[model samples]
Target: MKLLKTDGIVIKKVDHSEADRSLTLFTKNFGKININISGIRKSKKRHLNGADLFGVSNFIFYKKEDYYILSSFELNETFFDLRKDLEKLNISFHILEILNSVLVENETRIGLYKLLLNSFRFLDKNNKPIKNYLLLGYFLLLLIQGEGIMFNINDGLYFDIENSIINDLPTFNKLTEIQKIIISNLFDKKINDIVSLDPSVDDAKSIILLLEDYMNYHLNLKINFKEFF
Candidate 1:
């Protein structure tokens, strides 16, 4: 049997055989994978609980046929502070939901993996929920770019959502100037730099909605992100 190790964050978990858990993780070395952890649910160890949703850990696994079974793990960031605020918690879940939706299994997305860690850090450390709303937009913008379906920035003034393009003429789904700017900032600026732009809560929400539509259209994935924020 081959043993493998990676830094991974649990994105989803399912109960199995009463005490075991099937965890879906987005990892640094491997993009997304599913591993089975035995006795974690019933285990009294505090460290084992780190395998819970959104928890980052250094995971060791051994292959059993085509499946990977958990061997041991070292706990990393849980970003537990995000749970202190409802909006922040929701935003974090929203990001994870999108990740679960789009990331291909066994594909290497190191950039997005790093981005997820950074996003969690930003959400956990920052006090402003409004900025987090924009941060969600930033995550989605980069996600779209990472998927290689993002709209062209240099092509034109109006964005065509259906075609994922920018054109001289306006389309039915043309983004407003402010909306365009927000996307640019989210894509180009640092998390701290986004605060200088000072987007209102409403502005952030609107841009996120736009991004949702863009993602749905381009990726053919339905994400009902409205309930989160």
Candidate 2:
């Protein structure tokens, strides 16, 4: 067995036994890996907190054949404030679910992990009516990073979702000038600035749906959660 120590984010956790959990972690060095975390349930207060969904930690584990066994973990950030509101919590889960679905095991995506962590921090700090849109923006950023899409801010060009390029303007009957501006800015603006804009809930939802479809088409993965609203 090869022992390793690294920083990771908890992507998913499932109870395997009375006191053991099967966890999926996205690590800085090792990418995503499945690990068996024992004794969490028995610890109740302490270990349980470190193993929560969206928890970032420094973990010690040992690799054995195909899987990793988690020996110890030090909690970094739980993003606990997200739990204070039900809606925010739901949005956070949606973000994690998308990542869990797309990110492959043993594929290094250190940049994506950093983006997710920063987005979670933004959610915890900011107050915006369209919180889901902010998360959707981060999702779009990840898609752009993974797909190698070009974003041109100065020209106000839109992404040809099918081609994954910023050449053609978006063609949707319902999109207004303001909505187009918002989408353009999404492709160009800084993460913090984009999240601070207060678009109406309906408008935000519409943009998010369109972007989700674009991502689905490019990634060849159906995003069924777009129908949640």
Q: How many collisions between residues are there in candidate 2? A: 0
lDDT of 2 by residue, 54-107 (tens): 888999999888778888899998877877867677677777777887888999
Once fitted onto the true fold, the runs of candidate 1 whose alpha carbons sit more than 4 angstroms away are: 154-158, 166-168, 190-194
The alpha-carbon lDDT assigned to residue 145 of candidate 2 equals 61
Candidate whose lDDT is highest: 1
Local distance difference test values of all predictions, in order: 0.83, 0.73
Per-residue alpha-carbon lDDT of model 1 for 182-225, expressed as tens digits?
Answer: 77767776656657777678877888887888888888998878
Model 2 lowest lDDT segment of ten: 150-159
TM-score of 2: 0.85
